[model samples]
Target: MHIKKYFGRMLLLSFLTLPFIQGCAFFDNYARIWVASGQYGTDVKDLIAHWQDYNISYAGLSIENPSALLFDTKIDGRSITYEKWVPVTDENVLMTIVKWL
Candidate 1:
């Protein structure tokens, strides 16, 4: 009887912690957009302003084809594929991206 009770308690604790553990993994797979940009860093500020003008709720922007100055992204399960251009004005685009986060 004591063994049975202990097992029951252990099972309950595991179930209670399951959601928390899953949540960590869930957020890990989510991708956050930092910013969007156009050629020569043009239209960035305007784009942001446009979103605001339209009352869009967005964390950041993602460019689809940096070469073409387009933005594309995909969200599936616990993975995100976001593409964006690196502003030419910024010397270190990678660092800038990290800073946006």
Candidate 2:
């Protein structure tokens, strides 16, 4: 019983540390990218242009209420409707959209 408890604790610790390790790599890849949240409009174009200037990829954009036009096409690995942006800092964006908790 004690051995099982130790194993579980170790697993939990590893899970917790995984994010920190991944975060480092994420920041390295997309530290230049910025996060923006607001209404979906012409602003998206402006943001994209800004990032392009820096050669930084668009990580993610969170709008208050997305529209069909947003997801009509895929911008990154995941569809825009799904709120999945490419070259993200990491999968952290998933957590941000799903829970919004």
> Can you write out model 2's per-residue Cα lDDT over 1-101, one digit (the tens) per residue?
99999999999999999988787676666757556567634354463333332222233345222221221223454433333433323334323333331
Per-residue lDDT tens digits for candidate 1, residues 27-78, read 8647764445565253455544333222121224542222333222122224
Model 2 quality (TM-score):
0.27
Error of 1 at 70 (Å): 23
Clash count in backbone of candidate 1: 6
Q: Pick the candidate with the highest TM-score.
A: 1
Model 2 root mean square deviation, Cα atoms: 13.8
Candidate 1 Cα outliers beyond 4 Å, as residue runs: 26-101
lDDT of 2: 0.44
lDDT of 2 at 38: 70
Candidate 1 has its poorest 10 consecutive residues by lDDT at: 64-73
